[model samples]
Target: MAGVQDQLEIKFRLTDGSDIGPKSFPTAASVATLKETVLAQWPKEKENGPRTVKDVKLISAGRILENSRTIGECRSPLCDVPGGVTTMHVVVQPPSTEKDKKAAHLPKQNKCVCVIL
Candidate 1:
């Protein structure tokens, strides 16, 4: 058998429902770089949101992506709709840890968490 290696186009959709086309880069491009590219293309108004790329997290195929890692199993909903203001459907997840629960101020400590991706 032969090994097949090819490049894939990664597209990022902002929280404002704006789509950034796939950029041609090696699959090894870091998540941080991808974020930077996405932010550059994002509308000015949307960039003023409370959260920036540093505060936001990226996940693909059930695994949290690291800043140094490349895109794999890429999926949509990378950027979350802050404060439930957008028409886009989102899933909301409860706090997962005691600290998170305390911060969110949930009445219970051990409740199952819901994660909106």
Candidate 2:
């Protein structure tokens, strides 16, 4: 077991305008586990939003964190993050609704078309 110093206090900034934690998690914890914690604590709402891990992206220091990496592997040792409290940004990518899908496939008008007299 690691000592208290090894534990990292992390806060999440969710896309739904929700902020979760300043919670302590072992630095050894995998990014996948971190995502799970965020998803669990994510606010439940009627509005459509990211419903699975695949729909969400967690970014730290301008880099999207990979699920396979451990906090310690990304932080200490590798030294990506500093000691003490840290905040990460979460992006929710909800699957597009059918209406949006239809619009995307529609042909876009060319803005620079020349009129033939």
Residues 31-69 of candidate 2 have per-residue lDDT tens digits of 888888887887676255567777778888778899999
Off by over 4 Å in 2: 76-83, 96-117
For residue 12, what is the lDDT in candidate 1? Answer: 50
Q: Kindly state the number of residue pairs that clash in model 1.
A: 4
- lDDT (tens digit, per residue) of candidate 1 on 1-117: 111133445555445556557455454567777666655565565534323566545444445566776653342345422222111111112326588757777565686898999
Off by over 4 Å in 1: 1-4, 50-52, 72-117
Worst 10 residues of 1 by lDDT: 83-92
Judge candidate 2 at residue 38 and give its lDDT. Answer: 80
TM-score top scorer: 2
